[model samples]
Target: MSGSHVRLEPLTMDHAAGLLEAGADPGIWAWLSSRQPVELGEAEAIVKAALTDPDRRAWAQIDLASGRFAGTTSYYQIVAKHRILSIGHTWIGAGFQRTALNTEAKFLLLRNAFESWGAQRVAWETDARNLRSQRAIERLGALREGLLRAHRIRPDGTSRDTVLYSMTDAEWPGARARLLARLG
Candidate 1:
């Protein structure tokens, strides 16, 4: 998926070096389920795990201007029969945060899920402690459903409360408009 500021490409081991450089800051991995990759080998392992995950279709987010890997995102827990999917495990470099990159990236993913795949519902889950992520999700026009207590274990081995959000097919039009306006 191509956007003005970002392009989504199927992730591969070739992206390991770029991913490691872009995600150099340990802070970006704080709320993620996985630990920060401290070396090239670790980053390659991360990419390998993503590729082998049966339920996930991962992408390498590329910054168009620099033509470098910015981060990664994915559609996981997909249920084709129910037309449902979750978008998460997304992280962009600090340099790209608070910019059009994230908005456009999300717009592309949501568009593909709802329009191309006929997804009935799209979902997101974030660590409740990560207020920034929660706010970002709200900015995408997803409605907060509820909290899932002790939903998953954090990378640091502590239990985390997950804040759940979703957007339905019926609500996509409005969210789509909102995202476009933000991009413009």
Candidate 2:
């Protein structure tokens, strides 16, 4: 999917080097559920798995001006029959954080999910400790649904409390307007 300053292409093995470059800062992965890849080989493995994941679709975010990889995102826990899906596993390199890159990237994804797919709801959940992510979700006009205590097991074997958020079909009009204003 393409946006003014950012675009998302299918995640592929070819993006390994770009992922490594974008993820150079170790702190980028601090609150992520997946393990941080410390080497190109590890990044390659992760990309390989994402490419073949049956239940999810992954995309590599690209910086339009520089044509560089910025991060990765995915549509996970998809339930087509119910017209629901969760957008998670998103991370942007430190350089792109706080910029409109994230806003537009999200705008594109949400547009696709709701407008194109006719989804009734789109969900997001983040580690309870991730204040940045929490704020971002709220900024996108998603409602704080609730908390799921010990919702997931992290890569390091620790249980994580997840804070849930969502935007329903009824809420999308307002959310879309807000996102578009941010993108502007």
Candidate 3:
């Protein structure tokens, strides 16, 4: 998926170095499931896991201005027969945060899921404590459904509550328009 500010390409081992560099800021990994990758080997391991995951379709977000890997995102927990999927596992480099890159990347992914895949619903979940992520999802026009308490264990070994959001096919048109307007 290509956008003015960012392009989404299938992630590969070749992106490990760029991923490591872009992910140099420790703050970016705070809300993420994995620890920060400190070396090329660790970044490669991260890439390999994404590629090998059976239920995930991962992509490397390439910043158009610099033509470098900015971060990664994925479509996971896909259920083809039900036409449902969740978008998460996203992290943008510190430099790319608060830029048009995230909006365009999400717009492309949501478009593909709803239009191309004929999906009935697209869902998102984030750590309940991550207000920034919650706000970002709301800005994308996803309706907050409810919260799941103790949904998962954090990397620090603490129970994490998850905030859930969703956009159905019925809601896609409005959401799409909103996203486009933001991109403009």
Candidate 4:
């Protein structure tokens, strides 16, 4: 649950307010398909629902040095029997981006799923136009599995292509090691 620079913890009701506060900027969700929370109450409600889901996995990123709420992430296409999961719903506050907070958060999640839960693979998907996210996933050593054109509608009420990336158990150890090295 904890990583070197950040802690990937279960998203609880308590983090609702912090998430809203960190997400106050509407522009933050520009690239994400989800609706931006207009207020704290809305943020709380959405996070509350995500936490209680039986299969959909959600996690909050915590900054180790300051212990502040960094952002949130989740696994949606959960296939427990196949030991496969997908990491999505990811968005780090502007202050947290490009800061290695994301790398550390993912390293912990990948480590947990593959190491702790014996998962065969973990996945990541993003808007195909989101070049930044695409690169970030590649840096973690996730192979470019493929692209789902016209994947889904965005919050702006338009469609977007989805880029899929993944890391298998065999690749996680080395990927994890590289991520850790970047932290130093």
lDDT of each: 0.95, 0.92, 0.96, 0.86
Candidate 1 similarity to native, TM-score:
0.99
Number of the candidate with higher lDDT, 2 or 3: 3
Model 4, C-alpha of 60: deviation from truth (Å):
1.2
Worst 10-residue lDDT window for candidate 3 reads 30-39
Report the C-alpha lDDT of model 2 over 1-184, residue by residue, as the tens digit: 9989999999999999999889989899888866788899999988988878888899999999999999999999899999999998899998998888888888899999999999999999999999989999999999999999989988888999999999998999999998888777
Provide TM-scores for the models.
0.99, 0.97, 0.99, 0.93
Q: Is candidate 1 or candidate 4 better by TM-score?
A: 1
Best by lDDT: 3
Summed backbone clashes in each candidate are 0, 0, 0, 0
Alpha-carbon runs more than 4 Å astray in model 2: none
- What's model 2's lDDT at 67? 93
* Residue-level lDDT tens digits of model 3 in 1-184: 8989999999989999999999999999999988999989999999999999999999999999999889999999999999999999999999999999999999999999999999999999999999999999999999999999999999989999999999999999999998999899
Clashes of 1: 0
Residue 76 in model 4: lDDT? 81
Cα lDDT, model 4, residue 167: 92
Which of 1 and 3 is ahead in lDDT? Answer: 3
Predict model 1's lDDT versus the native.
0.95
